[model samples]
Target: MRSIIAFFLFIFLIHSVQAAPLLQATISRESQVIGNDGVTHTSVFQERMYRDQNNVWLERVLPKHHQHSTDAKNKTSHKHLDLSETAQHYFLDNKKSTRLNLVLPEDKTVIHLQTVDIEMLGLTNCWTCVFSIFDSQSVKKMKITQQGNGYTWYESQNAKNKIKIKWAKLQPDQNPHPTSEYYATMDSIWKIHLERICRLWGLNLVKE
Candidate 1:
């Protein structure tokens, strides 16, 4: 009886460790835009993410302290926005096949999608891959080119859109905080932009 109780205690401890939540926070993000008029503008923001096993929550931090609105008559209105309202939650299940549930906070709506491809389950940890799963057709057409150790370049078939990413190096004793910088160019509209990630936590880097 003593040996059996010890075995059960060990199993419970393993389960508790596996159920721990991972918190990922992006402290800052800088975005630079160059328009056709030869003008450049830059903006910065922050984001937070949390993952508990198969569920993840992504929150985009709005720069404004209050949510602003304009009436039909062009009148401006301001209202305080709750931080909790900014999160979009994702739930993934891979029991038999890959399945996803995207929950939108504003409308309290749940979007469900399922696929037979098992590989899709592994991509939930990536920032881009989460959205790419919704548009697998477009992802198939895009070409990926690796420049070197931490640089990746992507281009459209028409060459009208291009994106380059610089990934951060892995650190010791961490759950993989994969911060990155993105440089995107849209030749069709003569626009170029650079988005840099200042800090990140929790997400794993999957190099394509």
Candidate 2:
């Protein structure tokens, strides 16, 4: 009789847990990276990600806008070659979070890290799962204020150059995929890179 009662209780617990939805957060950030090589890079990256303590995955396409690079050695001519790409990323916690395995099925890449790392945004992950704390707002590790549609963030400021590294997070129900609007935005930012396509279609970059 005790065994029967315990079995029913266990079943009830499982059903109650299943009824609760997973906790997911979307983190979006736009900022400039000042390289030690004396070059600055501007990137606008948005990610729609999912996480529930132990499981995480890239659900949909996240928008990305990255301006090309420059080197002080080549500062005279400053060649900017913007690039655009598409991919997906997923991760599963296996006993530990620091020893998580990052899976980029789209690019056929898997990384087994020794420790939790919070670096290289919008590059390594297919879409964006979690790069240490990047997928979470706590990644900022700095003070922020409530902004119009999102929270204003800044980890540091370059007073000499008058540039304050800023970031923001906007919560929206819409998931942006590889839609026409996305292409138009990328097409404008990378006009030179997409010159061939623009020429073929005889279309000009939309200028605001």
Best by lDDT: 1
lDDT of each: 0.41, 0.31
lDDT of 1 by residue, 1-208 (tens): 0011212111011111233434444445566667789777777656555554544455666656744466788765436333334344454443522244433344343334344322343324343344221233443465766546654444443345454333333455333222443445552222222233223344343211
TM-score of each: 0.42, 0.32
Q: After superposition, how far is residue 192 of candidate 1 from its true place, in Å?
A: 15
True-structure lDDT of candidate 1: 0.41
User: Model 1 Cα displacement at 185 (Å)?
Assistant: 2.8
> Model 2 — TM-score against the truth?
0.32
Pairs clashing within candidate 2: 88-126, 89-126
Q: Hey, what RMSD does candidate 1 come out at? A: 13.1
What are the candidates' C-alpha RMSDs? 13.1, 18.4
Model 2, residue 84: distance off in Å is 8.7
lDDT of 2: 0.31
